[model samples]
Target: MTFVIDRYPCEESPRLGAMILLPTAESVPRARRWFRKFIAPYNPACSVGDCTLMISELVTNAILYGRADEGWCVRVEWFREGTSLRVDVHNPGFPANVRLRRPDADDAHGRGLLLVDAIAESWHSGPSAFGGTVVSFVVADAWPA
Candidate 1:
């Protein structure tokens, strides 16, 4: 599952968006389900497939890398700008040291960010405004034409 990421500057987009807070790993699916419903109104121009895949990967990373015992909630957010979609996952922990790794075939993990970098038009991570980390990506094709 690899793809080339297109880099292009887009115009200023409206701030229209939504946010969801998932308090546990078990709630990741609920976030996806919510996103599905959230994007149903858009015409087929939006890339639902990419959005779903990225959402799962980002949320999974948040859950697996955060301190669950500390009530670390994963905050998922999305915004629509022109024909693009920005998805962000905020975790109550510092951002993971993300890097591309040539994992062995026998390795069962460590490819999440690789997949994200391959698919997302642009992505980055940094300190969250809420005192943790926020990983965000923009999918240019996931917006209405």
Candidate 2:
């Protein structure tokens, strides 16, 4: 079945910033570009630049840990609720592991969520209804001083 994601009226969410339902590993960069668009007209105080970074982290994680021999897809969505921006990346993978650990001095990788955790006010990964999982983050719209 086809799904329709409603585009909120500009005034209904005039302060919002986001990218949504992107489908491809290539779309990760596209998501970044779209992120620029989403936040461009907003007050610099409401930027989602870190959200874009987390998108990269989560999407890369999905591509690395969740890719299957069967067909799979990935998507990213974002929006503003009050003073917080919500970023969500969805991918069609069950995940081989979902544990969070501190990054080690010698480790070259495995620090995606660590970065994500540091940036967003709060974030988590969850199973999706459409046969995969979602990583979501909420960030305060406070601009860097």
Candidate 3:
């Protein structure tokens, strides 16, 4: 499926970078690497570790729940929003299905969104204008003084 990456108004923020990933288990690590490389120049100001972790979770969810088959793809985009950084993960999934759940101690899964909630300065999920769901999060003071 062809998906378009939505761009915020220029007054809001400029996009840093974007990448498309195949919906697969391997994409999780690939996303992390790509995120790190994409934000390398902004180091010290940007929380690379935290952002990488969050992106990993988001990408994993896109692979597991978003894609109906190998034919679909996941898109990740990042933007520099003033002193903060915003990242978005888009997939062909139901927007309403993205939520934080209280995972049981024994459960080996379902903690992805939980981690995102605890770390991100702000976050939300909704239907994308181009189609499908888009989960986005912002990290405040990303460009520290």
Candidate 4:
């Protein structure tokens, strides 16, 4: 599996960081670690725990549903918008398949987006510029110094 992270810094804003994963189950933990480390210094309203949980769920879905063949990958992007921390996950999967479904009590799967909806101030999914699916969420708190 291949991993790529891009850090884009703006003079007046928080650095925007992104990662591309190979869509393996391992990528889920890696994504969570990356996100936790990146946001460590930029305090957000949501706890790091919440953020990482969301990351895990999103990356898990990507690994499970994304096209992981050669040259295809799942992408994770994050940045600070004012007091809000925004995270976006994209995968080479059909956008139509990305949706929230109520999971049954005994079902272990299908609860990812439901957790996201409960935690994020706002969230959404759609087609990416690269002809894949993109899911994003925002959590707001205090601004970093």
Indicate which candidate wins on TM-score.
Answer: 4
| TM-score of every model versus the real structure | 0.78, 0.74, 0.87, 0.88
lDDT of 3 by residue, 3-93 (tens): 3334344444478778788887878888888778767765537578999999999999988888453377889999887788999999999
Indicate which candidate wins on lDDT: 3
lDDT by residue for model 4 (47-131), tens: 8899889989988988788874466788888877777788888888878898899999999779999999999898999998766
Cα RMSD (Å) per model? 7.9, 4.4, 3.7, 2.2
The global C-alpha lDDT for each of the candidates, from Candidate 1 onward, is: 0.70, 0.67, 0.83, 0.82
After superposing all C-alphas onto the true structure, candidate 2 shows an RMSD in angstroms of: 4.4
Looking at candidate 1, the ten consecutive residues that score lowest on lDDT are 1-10
* By TM-score: ranked, best first: 4, 3, 1, 2
Q: Write the per-residue lDDT of candidate 2 for residues 72-139, one digit (tens) a residue.
A: 65666667677666777777777446556786899999888988888889988778656677778888
Q: Which tens-of-lDDT digit does each residue in 1-145 have in candidate 1?
A: 1111222223353434454555556666766777777566544365677778888888888877765455456777667766787877888766665445777889999888878889889999988887678888988866546
Candidate 3 — number of clashing residue pairs? Answer: 0
Instruction: Give the poorly placed runs of model 3, Cα more than 4 Å off.
Output: 1-13, 68-70
Candidate 1 ranges beyond 4 A from true positions: 1-16
Which residue pairs collide in model 1, if any?
83-143
